[model samples]
Target: MAEFPRNDMATAQDWLRHAVAADAAGDVAVAEQGFLQALLLDAALVDARFGLGVTYFRSARYREAALELRAVMAAGSADAATGILLGKSLYLTGEFPESAKAFELALTSMPLQGDSLRCYARAKTYATMIAGNIADALADYPALAGAEAEPIETVIRDGFGLLSAYGHRDAAAALGQLLITENPDDVVQRHLNDAVAGRAIDHVPASYVEAHFDAFANGFDDKLVNVLGYRVPEQMAELVSRHRTAFDHVLDLGCGTGLAGAHLRPLAGELTGVDLSARMLEQARRRDVYDALTHAEALTHLAAHAATFDLVFAADTLIYFGRLDAVMAAVAEAMTPGGIFAASVETSMHDFEIMPSGRFAHADAYVMRLAEPYFELLERQATDIRLEANTPAKGALFVWRRR
Candidate 1:
């Protein structure tokens, strides 16, 4: 086995610290060199890449900027700032559809103000105008979706994604429209189709959630933990431990890849994991922390296990639900008196809004109102849940006791 110095991580972090300082001090050359050195030491370090990408972006190096920024996003940082920068880079490179998606995600995180708003509008207008000519440009796309060789839905989605990647803005939009026309009742297709059309819908279908998680189940943990800096599982577990030493029965709702299950295992006498995605459940099963792993939607599983749990942990789960009324009532019914319900959620000002990203965010006040009748708020703390486009995404973590 090859051995190296034990301080590689410490040394890499030191390099990262220096790089950030240099970047902030406007020493682009030193900053870039420092970032490169940091990456050489610890290739998995995302901060170095982010800093390098920023430096490259500032230097009119759009291609390098785009490459590094894309890598940062692929690793799990999708904040408005990163998205905006990436969008600009791609746009400058003449990748309009890809740029549109980046700008769209950025706009969802935070609405563009002043000049940024004008720029966004310009981009949107250009993309829209280009889309009007897509049908004539990709005359065979509509026919390709109906081809008998592959699933119609698969063909359409893949074709749309490919066209977008290749900067075929209008063509991709046309394909998306075809998808909607062909699969009018298909929730996943409709939601994605709507996204491409820049429409925000109130409800996200269960099928969309299942398919999204299942598709990314394999890399879920790495993206969430390593890339995005997700700490909800650990944070929630720590909060729960502060109140209770152990739980007789614990239920993990929306336990994708068993992250929360793995954290809560030591505290749970019997851990049960539930999720909408079978692939996610399979990933959870491999962790072996859960005594039972069930493939079912949160509400459906909660309905079958009424008054069954002493503790229910739902980390990064409830964001899928825009309205918590039925699910909250169901959760209350499913919990024993005085049982704990710990969860984290994306924060928003409105009661609940399905953002352009297709996920829901609830205001703290709204969540409190929903839990008032059934769960007593034991603890609620606001924290950075993860990195979105290299920016800290705000979220609120709560531990409530069933009344």
Candidate 2:
């Protein structure tokens, strides 16, 4: 091996100079060793730590890179370049929320363009899907840390809409708790508070679902179809057409705003729709496609109804449920023998996983297992459900038959 600086008596500056030279000459191993030596000689050397972090990052040692970059940040030596590097390191390690904050800081000096900007946007979108993690509000409002509760509450409630929407649950829960304390009947805030506080919930509460869809019923169609490019209903309708041409009776479970009802109407002799949201039912009723629209939960209606339907389909509805045992059993019981069943689900590896976006994705195996006793699998097709955060959300459509 060539002679290299290994003397304990060598000054930190000497090691740092050698490290910089090695780095410039692309001698990664020597550069890393020199940087470590420089940091050992002078623990407070931010330059040495930054150099080590760059070496680690280049070598794809992301966790090590983050440690050194974080140390540089804590040393008050962070600049736009440091922030960008730190952000990239955190992002590669799947710390999207923290990465977003780092990228945001970098934007103060760096031009708002290129990979950094794209990464920031993607990270921010993913961050919003996360819930239950408390945000350090002090970062944005250091002065408010010691301020009175009244002012903090006011700020969160009145002016922190963007922060709350960004999955900063602590700020949102603070505001929600304040609102709930003042008005006991604020169901919306109560539900939001429960969700962010780690309350046990197998599925979204019916009241919450009703209120949510009711509030959005007016713009639901335009938002899903035009803005989000939602095509699950159209895809589901096509799936049904391939397996069967028509049915004497059809049930559209959780038929929201009549999106699926309109498509299924042509194939049904008598179509019935059921939903938890009355506002959604009102919108569905406007289509005049269903012979009957029942304002009730899908499972409740399914449990009560006899085996009269020859076709049952739910388009873009199963995402609210983390467990399909109860609903699947109810659907199985409600359908006539040899009847068709079709539905769509966001896909995951787990039997079922509650996503950060407050939706559930089920493994294909789980769905097949649930339907095995009651139905024969006809077809399973994977496709993009919709645009979430400007990215295609992958999901599967399943068609089955009652045993």
Q: Kindly give the number of clashing pairs for every candidate.
A: 5, 0
Error of 2 at 172 (Å): 6.6
Most accurate candidate by lDDT: 2
- What global local distance difference test value does model 1 have? 0.78
Off by over 4 Å in 1: 1-175, 178-186, 194-202
Error of 2 at 63 (Å): 24
Lowest summed lDDT window (length 10), candidate 2:
141-150
**Pairs clashing within candidate 1:** 77-389, 78-388, 78-389, 79-388, 79-389
List the candidate 2 regions with Cα displacement exceeding 4 Å.
Answer: 1-185, 189-200
- Model 2 pairs whose backbones collide: none
